[model samples]
Target chain A: MTLPRRGPWRIVFVAALVVAAVIFVIPFVWLVSASLREPGYVFSTGLLPLPFHPENYREAFQAVPLPLWLFNSAVVGTAAAVSVTLSSAWVAFGFAYFRFPGRDLLFGLVLATMMLPFAVTMIPTYLIWSELKLTDTQVPLWAGNLFGSAFYIFLLRQFLLSLPRELFEAARVDGASYPALFWRVAFPLIRPALLVVLVFEFKASWTDLVKPLIYLRDESLFTLPRGLKVVLDRFGVRRRAGLAHRARGQRHRHDPDDHRVLPRPAPLHRRHRDHGPQGLSRARSGPCGRRGRWPSGSPRPAPPWSSGSGP
Target chain B: MAAPRRRPTLARREARWGVLFLAPWLVGFLVFYAGPMVASLWLSFTDYDIVNPPRFVGLDNYRQMLADPMVARSLRNTVYYTVLHVPLTMAISLGLALLLNRVGRLSGFFRTVFYLPVMTPAVAVGILFLLLLNTQDGLVNGFLGWFGIDGPSWTTDPAWVMPGIVLMSLWSLGSTVVIYLAALQNVPRELHEAATVDGAGSWQRFRSVTLPMISGALFFTLIVNTIAALQMFTEVYTMFFGNQSTQQRFDADASTFYVIYLFQQAFQFLHMGFASALAWLLFLVILVITVVQLRLSKRWVYYESEES
Candidate 1:
């Protein structure tokens, strides 16, 4: 099964590796290039930054509460990671150390929960939070982790099982309390698994848009992903805003250097209050263009002066 | 019962301690999982708006689902996406793992390059792919144009939307690649050598020896990926429905997945009961699919323990 060390086979192998590497890396290059362009040139076909406008970063910062969102995301991610790690580890230790009545059945129940879709419990869970008067608060986002996620419990339990029973027994013989047995003996041994749980849960919390979309309505309370959703709503979807502004014969006020701009879409403050149930209906009739006029329906609008052609 | 009047046995004492340690999860199970599950099942039979008490509707919600066009469309869309996504992910990951397994010192670098996208937040990936999949000026289309292929309008076309999503999902197949790589490394070299001595060519060795050796990981990933693909939300939602303002502009019917429809029912339309029914339906689908997969695995998946 080993690749031939020398000849045309080695050359082909290297070429394949290089091609795969380029395919994987190019999207990131395109992302950085697009981010650097003047907002007008974002959709312009390019894989390289020729005329970079670093000011776009500054404008984006001023346009949105990016710092506040980052802070909120960090807090939520840390809380979720730390709580799930600690709680899942504790539960896993119990499963690993003790042979109790109905233990196998209980463990099976825990594993079965992994198969249950979150959609089933989502509505009831929301109702539970609303009943506790905690809806729209950050508590709903990370507080559930205190209960220990089933997946993490199962993962950490597997790690704990690999440890020799004699190590725990030795500690018990030395008059260690049960909690002390876990803390002093098993805890240190499973540090790597705990770390894995921490990282995974943190990523889960950080990337989570649905939970925040469901729970948080306040603008100031938004995590990074939720804030990004708002950003996409305003800027990402309607790339034609700049052209529409120029066609209307009004120069955007703030930047004399850039004529290809319009005033920021509806005030951020307006959206803050309008995120209620009524907002859902309002959004149905929002200012988005008609479906018939989608970019795909018409000929490719000649990339607003394409500098980088098909690269 | 009378025998229990004696001092607690060592085993009983240990069991008490075990229960004590398990208290947090026990409480969590009651509050978060068991309680909500029961409530969800009950709510599925009632008409519930958040403001008012639930009115028992006696299976009307389930009956509505039977006639709901959107429910059927969403399920079809999910199944289509699952069929496309799960196999592609598994195959590509296995391919990448095989490639990586052949490499020597540069393996870690390639592995990291592949896994990096998995670490990127799904929302970020969604946004990035939205830009990359843009019909006219997108990087993907641009790449295709280099090959003289006319790229379809990925996000806007109903026919191509699921394929677009499948492509985006493949970017995060790095996790699966890592899993497959682990499994591949665990395949005993002696088995391959033994096969080679028995007049097996490389392809024959791969088909006979490599496939079965890694079938457990393959089966595990198949089930996990199938379940995940069916439940897919964050990335699809971010790319397609993140903007409520422009949500209608896209091919809504085509891209509307089962979970998305469920979310709409529970949250947007306030059809909480209907949403619960939708959830239960999904649960049953998953249960049936998993059971079938396990059964089918008996024919193909070779376990060393079973062989012994």
Candidate 2:
């Protein structure tokens, strides 16, 4: 255990660590460099931001409602975090403090729910929201957290269990009411664990794309992830535009009307249409290169569908 | 008699308080989880689009799924991802954690650096990796080219798609590393010292002293990462299929994980009943895998209480 700190091994270890750290970090570095490049040079084989076009940021915001999406994400993340933290804490406290019949069984059920895939509950949950006329609204995104999440409940319960039962017993002996024992005694004591749950749930909510994709059909109501999805769909083919421009040997100018390079948004009603299985089949067989599809005449991007041949 | 009666009432009061505290979860369990579960199970048995009343069509959805090539394709894709992603992530994270445990002065800085990726939103990670994994001009390929390695077309080739996704998932191995670091820290230092005194080599000491102590965390991560890899959706969906509004181009069949297929069935195709069946199948697969893991854990997962 007392191996000498200063040695050839030490130098090797530090070098390895540095290499690993750089490997992990290079993606963000590349993204930043790519973001600053001229549209034509974005797919160019360089890591530096040569011919920097900071206007890409301004154009991106204008192209999509970034600020609105950010605000919506913050709101949804906050609501989900706060509600899940409080509710899960309350439920955890109950399980931790209580001595009642079926408590173990109920707690076991809560733990079991963690293993149940969301896909199992997804459809009927959608149905329930639809029945309540809450679809396309933000209500379905965070409102479900009012009923404590099983994972958070299990987490907080473990935290609560670590607390001394004597502390709660002392409060009860002081003629403190049950609710007072929870709010006054236990809640403050579990603040750190509650913060953990809050942060985890908030991150989950912020990063979540599935719920938003399923529920928030309205562009204005979109969370960041959903909004980003829209951005990806609309601008996914921008690389093709870059390729086309490059093929013609034209230097790309950063144009304000670059948004026009995107296909027009489908009409709201038509975009939201409920395509049945038949429509799905038809769409599946439809022509390529529309929307997020690879633009037809351009050289195909490397990855997913393309062969290994360099474009 | 009076004393006994008071005892009963006191116990009753505590029970009532317990029920009151637990009421929210109980209601949530029933309304959100239990009710929907039952409804979905029923829905799986019927033929229902959102617009129409469900018509009973027992076993038809399940039968269709058996014949559905996409179902098999998606399952194979998911399993491929899980098999690759889980073990590689575990090994890499554990290795990082072990190294972090050795460092004294700069461990916190390194840990923070490693964990920064875990905080990046999945959608952002997807986009970032999408760009970074591009074969022709990607930074990854550019880096590989430094060693004269020709990187495969990551997102484009069906053969390499899952591997690409695995690489992307590895980028967020920070959380797993952090978990392992915590577990490594908890492995009593004295045990390692004792093993050293007993003439055990560093490798031997680690294999015996270090691993068993952290087996619980390792097992927990295994189950969690397995479940997560199976349900892998957001990043893959974002990278490959996020732009479904576009016309059908080349099929990224390998990228279509099970959940993505379920999502398309339910939302895009409005085949709610069929989607429900797909979901239930996933549920059963997850259940079986989890059960198998739990059973297997008894052999290797160490619990301090059991020795006591």
Candidate 3:
């Protein structure tokens, strides 16, 4: 299509795009704003953060085991990405370059496996891992990638199919080992597909919540998403009417709803003190104010009732 | 290109190399995927808790699933979500792609901006959107307030929870948009020019020339988005009830998706047998839907190279 040559239509087109972009970006902008703001200003509606506290990130780090969680996420993500990419490329090359019996059938089988959803195999797979004492470890999460994934293999095979077969033949004739031919010739030619596999596998591992939720028991072993869940559950406001009711200044001071929204900073800080140096600060800037739940007066959470104690 | 040198020994060795290369994946399939598939099928017919040996129950688990209210609710919720989500996502992604395709110079910049959402971790997106869709101080409600419209309590209200999740799901339209963009760019410009010369207007040219070329991508995104919507978990899980506490509970009734219920049955409740039956049912549903989609694609999906 021709450009509209600086007409009003062009301006309208650009303006519409800008609006869409802003709408897409507002969540991220809110995350950044909420993360940076002082605990008191979290309920503020304005976009630009007032009394910006970059220290909340430091406190966020202190509040939870952020470093450990980040580290675990990296390890699993990298392992899955690297293993999936290499194995998928290796398997794809075998299918693409070699003229073997059952090659088409085997590749078809690989594609067919993609149809089976994870839930179908999830329970038995977990049992197998548990039986092998692999549960509660990071192994189960990334080990599946050691055997080439069906989707990645299919993707790489399609890419390999497009490349001239001559490259592999030429490399083979040059006295190169079969493995060497794959590594030197086929692997380099399929770099884009490999990169795609790497990114896909990394992101899949990084954001996976179910596998970790099932496999991991130890809090120390949790990944970022798991840790984030812990933080949200611990600090998030729960009542359905909390945010809206509080916003209108109609909230009763002694109501149970009030306790769910307000963060009792001193007690929370004291609790965090046992965990780490910055736990208190983390609690102060936690999911409470980010929720914009309460306008005032912090309510203390009731202590858990002891067994055999009557209400 | 190398010459077709058919050395007898080398050809024989190539077959050996091929099997050797396939061995890793083959072993993986047997041990991980194939083995578990069989095991789960067996497990579905029995009462199995993780701690004890599985006992044969002879379709009891499946029978129980038929009676379970949550199973029906979950299925209804999943179907509702998939029905709403897949079509809306297709429309939005296609619209974005068409918009990006028309804007010449800044398309690259806008494309990057649009694609940014897909790169953010899904868990992070969930949490971010949870806050963004809050009833009172959320950016969404704040925007709605500008027009004097009171936004529903998105996060907490059972009625609005799935809609909130669906809106959040739209943020990850980047990958679909990219696929559509690639397909859009591939539509033969000659077809457009010819149609224009034939006095076809822009909409008519697009309908007759552009859409047919991109039908393959449309078919692909449809199948993918449907399958994905059926498995909706992380976003809804994070937004409504986190994993920390009440990990067993499907808090908001409307947001209890099929996969999430399956997950709770297997892990939280330790009803592995029942969950397996639920899973097999899900498998059948997906298989049927996919087969139906593939069948339906013959009607609308245009392949440029196919002989009529």
Candidate 4:
């Protein structure tokens, strides 16, 4: 019974690996093939033998101002990542080093905050930004995440906790000040975790859609996901209208300028939503009345995400 | 070198410096995290449309949640995802980690290759899958055809949608494999050697020694994986709703994950109270599962301290 295994198990393991590779690769292969397939051929293309179309990417490019959106995403993602990392790491140092009153309680609350739904804060946070007059700017888009972000703080604290307390004791026995000790001792030890946090923050912020959508009303400020949304929504309406017009067959009878059927997205090619004066026509940035506030000004009276009476 | 601080002022200054170090995190938690959490609990008791002022509604949100059919469906979907994904991840990661533990070549490179998926932006992954799983031009069905087994339209069919989510999850099991590999390296060679002397095969040694030795790591992974699965938002958000075309989907109900459903109710429909209730219930579910796992782990998880 066992002799068979020496031969078959090796074959079996190889077969299993082959099966696993198929599982991982098949879906991804299909996606690249589909994304490259043109919209016209999209419906008709059979799976394996279909001709590869590089033009679908061109169509996708034509469909959206992907370059600008990509740029905006990079900026926003990087800003959030850097800000969150520095703040979180600095804050985590405090939690890790100090024996403060309410530290445990505060840490518990931070962990508990991880459970808080974004919806509960959505209105209040929006209202705060509105009140502060920062609604349309990239300032609001960057929306400096505080140092005490529970998740990152906890992560850094855990890393710090794993360090030998004797190291801290040894530093204190010497001439090192607390700040110098943290900077000199703790920071070096937790470099790995800090690097992880930066990557995590970048990925989280870059892929995020809802935050930018709420805070940044300016078309120039749209992140990749928001920019992507505008394209998808606009193109969808256009495709629908275009389809209808095609169905009607060259009817010059319809009002040519009527935009009710065709939805035009903000022209992504320009820094402004549209270079044509019609696009920049100032609109109320919604009920968020005081929308011009930036951090470059005095410390804003209200929290960035809260409409609560100013602190 | 220097001496200990001579003055009371210096000791006091050191204490103050420590406080200053912690102050940023402290202020952020109280203002952003704690404030919102308490606000959410309060909002759970009120009828909030977000735009309109919230009104006191007592337990109406919780009552409505009890009556909500979608809550049950979402809960079922979540439990199914957690149950299926956790064991599958464990099995796959362990298998891969074991295979690579004694590998002859490029161990570090293979480890990095596995972890690449975990680092990928989840939305990009979703988009990537969307392209691949396109019913018509998708590569999956093309391979299926080779096997003489036709796969269903993965995203289109309700039966296949959750499976798609699960498969997407399994592909990212590299993180778990890395952790498992780290644990595997520490398995006492003495135990494997002792078992080897007793005529034990690789399978027997793994069962009696490796499994028991790594039970703590297994426990930790289970709780973390459960929490990750329960809080799964980005994948479902991108896959089903966030990146959804405005076109009507095949099974509208099937597309929503439990967490995503809660997000929609609160954000899209402005049912903040109901959403809070859903969040609170999820918190309880996670807490209960965590407690149960911890209790069970006491029996099987051997602390190194115990043997010492």
Candidate 5:
């Protein structure tokens, strides 16, 4: 324990690592806990609830049209991912592996967009989409990905450049056209990079709340984030009713008064007859908040979608 | 090794194939990028609200933004966020990369663990943080109690709000770590061997040799990171803080950033001319800062196969 014997650096390093790990871990655990807290107590209750409210998850499911939004996100993100991957890989093979005219100048133009602020093009893109009659559809989200983003093309080109020249030469010897070589040979080799593009693009499109909020106005066409936005806007009388159901269903207790915790009187959930004033409000409050796949804070995406703001 | 006549044919063929393949991205850039950019610049000079036929008002919008205080504050906050977040992220990611490089057991597992956050949809990540950072009974405050620390109400508190964004930003530092890890692999073993032979310890070697070797990557990440931070939108606007109307919820003078204001002006208020003007200003700021960085990079950014 002497200063000469024990280095403080070891202690600090371990502490930093441990704290970072805890910082990462606790929130995920708390999210799951918050989602399951009793309907009355969920928001009112802290991160650690004594009892699990199974109903919160059930209520969350009912509140949002989960299946449809999820399906919408999947279809949009997946289609975008697939098309972008192909386009990027093909374009990258040309940029990286081949010696071409105007290649550097062309790439310079493409790279220039990497610095583009969406503000520059957002309005014009909107006008274009409207004129194309594609403003309200999922087309805005997916179609751009098909054309291959300059970013992915650049990243893939960097990767392809590092690869050896022998493989492409071998493919060409067999009379493979550039397309055939790209598809049959280089494609499989670059599959790992392709996967990276897939996951990244998928995440980009999947979590893209702003564009969807703008383009897709129909409630039926709403994505998960868009649906959750509705829940975020409400500061209503039912806040108490929402908490009341959570209080009764909640298992653990550090707080003494569940009644005082809620902002308003508990609204009744028709299913929770025993838990009075809980079910009715939630039924009307709709599919939102700390539970199931959707979670809360998303229900009322401010009318800025078509007008602007969410992105 | 081939015939001399074949060289021209080879170059011609490659040129043809390259254009054919690059056609998609070129077309995309022309239509989506160049076209929009030029149109946006034109719109900046005129009063166009998407509905109105653009009326040329000269430099009026730019003049208005010059007087707007919100634009300045937003830029300040964004710079503040970048200043705080980028170094913290780079340090943490570099540290993680070093640890992963040394450790033999479960390195991939750690890598995977670090990256798990990337899988969660961003809004889900935001909502999840809403619960964790809740002031009253949130887990953060609860845990802070064990250490005699009182956690601030993250989202609601203006002072602490960007700090929450910083924390949220770090959760996705997985990508940064990956980039660092790849750069670390390219460090020449012989250079390290020479340094060690000169009686350099691990820390000394890292400082003198490893650091210089990774300067290329370091420069790339710095520019890319700064650019990303400058363009930061969704997480701040969607989760921790919001843009425009939400700014009205707190009011404009309180604590919003420039990008957020630009977003509000362009989208919410339908101040297309003003927004376009603001966009041009931002473009200039980014362009100027980047050129300065590039010019300054002469001192530190070293490449192995390039002119000194």
Candidate 6:
């Protein structure tokens, strides 16, 4: 029997959905408004900008090497995604198509690796990269991925396992080589899973800040996330006077501003004014107050626990 | 006898092909994952500062963690995030999925709209929230102003920092919603129809019928979401402590997640040994929680194949 489709239920459902939809878009709408906002007026409460200044995008490009950062992100992300997709597909092909001794046990190990936390391996990996002289370059960012990630392998294998065994057997009976079958038949059939791997890796590489932070030291090599972090730190709402300096730099100089947003080499008034009288006094005291300490002058205090080189 | 003879040789040939095809992952597994994992365990006992050779210091780092204030603080913050984030995300995602399922014709369009936020990079989302949650001029606070309510200083105020993160985490609920929607679609319509005939109201029918059918997906999302929430890092890192300025420290207590603290120990302070210990500790915690979740799931999670 057909149930009543029209009633209070329909109205309530529509109303609830409309509210949820608006909530989902609020941050996005604000991002657009803030990005288009006037240079100094970076924060905007409205959903839409009143006096839309699209020039902030231009200023942002000039302020940091936006195009270079995007290019770096693309190169790293694309390389990692491409490598991961190819390698994982190759590995998955073997697991799906073969019935070898210890295959199940080996595949189990692969699955186990997915749960292995980055924290456990990050330090040693960094050390290995440093030893190889791969640190401070983009090599560390995508090098590990050239082998393949466990999740992608597992995902592709599951997809491969679901396919009819007859297809592979037929190809093998025709005297097709394993690699030839993988390229001609398996690869085309598993396009969707491959796309998922590619998209996931690309997004991951694009958004990653920690890897770049741990590895890349030079400004020229920074990806978009790292570059954005630099921008936010230098020019967030708390630091109003920073925009003033940028504004001045735009007017006075033909060359790019030499100021790197570091602790000013000299404690100039511009730096002190932002921190106020109390901050200036702390800066004078040499130790710099704990709340406002910059790592530049004050060497990081050794943790109390580090005194254990053995008695 | 002839079939058995051919089988052995064919199996041998296939195994060889498998090994050849698997070479890339085999090399990767050895170099990237397995080697580093073993090295990490060893390094956890030695004090290494890339500049100098590691000096052996057995249990010192682990012992020190027992007294580290930041360790306690970050753990508390991480647990707090996981506890709130997982359930809230699950509820919101399921709710959105239910709503979208009801709005059957527009599911495709609405699904894209909802999923867009998940596609945006986490860094961009974090940066956007930094603006949206600004105390004075943020859209969130602005909207609050409409009701004559003053919003909390979200990122700046320690009290509101976790809530701010929780709010930001909700923006990416689109992925989870899509998963739940897929599960909902797979729920047999005949069951719902049967429930309706039995005089069960919509809500009643949902509670009794739909819930049990999609319990497997529900359980999967819950465990995955919980694991992710425990490892919350990138958004909080970019939003709060990622200072490129000479002063790398930002004293936002509520925002100091466990992974972030571990990262600071490893990279910022060069405490490689101590950080490895922290990493192992985190892994142990995750392993235990996952095991507990699996044990608990036996009572509630429904498997269709097991029914017969």
Per-residue lDDT of A221 in model 4: 72
Residues A79-103 of candidate 6 have per-residue lDDT tens digits of 9899999999989999998989989
Look at candidate 4 and give me any clashing residue pairs. A30-B132, A30-B139, A31-B131, A31-B132, A125-A305, A133-A290, A133-A291, A133-A292, A133-A293, A148-B25
Task: Give the CA lDDT, 0 to 100, for residue B76 in model 4.
Answer: 87
| Per-model chain A TM | 0.79, 0.78, 0.76, 0.70, 0.72, 0.78
* CA lDDT of every candidate: 0.78, 0.78, 0.75, 0.63, 0.66, 0.75
Model 4 agreement with the true structure over A19-122: per-residue lDDT tens digits: 55556555445455444543333323344424555655665656556677789889888888788777887877777777656668766866877755455455
Question: Under CAPRI classification, how is model 2 graded?
Answer: acceptable
Please give, for residues A1-311, the per-residue lDDT of candidate 2 as tens digits.
33325777767767777888988877777677777777767756667876777777777776668899999999999999999998988898899898899999999999888888999999898888888989778989999999898888888888888889899899888999988988999899989989999999999999999899888766899998887766666555454222211110023223322212234445655444311112222333463222322222222242232222111
Better of 2 and 5 by TM-score: 2
Name the regions of candidate 4 deviating beyond 4 angstroms.
A1-30, A37-52, A99-144, A155-193, A213-219, A226-311, B1-7, B242-247
What is the per-residue lDDT of model 2 for residues B1-308, given as tens digits with 9 covering 90 to 100?
69868988988988999999999999999998899899999999987766557778888788778877778999999999999999999999999888777765667888888998999988888877776776666678887899999988786667887888898999899989999989988877788889888999988988998899999999999999999888988888777674443223335676889998888778765667888999999999998999999999999999987996
| Residue-level lDDT tens digits of model 1 in B114-144 | 9989888888888788767867667798889
DockQ of 4: 0.18
lDDT of 1 at A42: 69
lDDT of 5 by residue, A1-311 (tens): 00111266555544555566666666676666655655556644455754665565565566657788889888988999999999888888878877766788887977878787776787777668867988668898789776788889988888787778888898789899888988887888778888999989988888877677556655577676665543442211133223211222233233332211223322433222211112112323353221221112322232222232111
Indicate the TM-score of model 1: 0.88
Candidate 2 vs 6: which has more lDDT: 2
Top candidate on DockQ is: 6
User: Looking at candidate 1, what is the lDDT of residue A209?
Assistant: 89
Chain A of candidate 4 gets a TM-score of 0.70
How much of the real interface does each model capture, measured as fnat?
0.48, 0.47, 0.48, 0.23, 0.37, 0.50
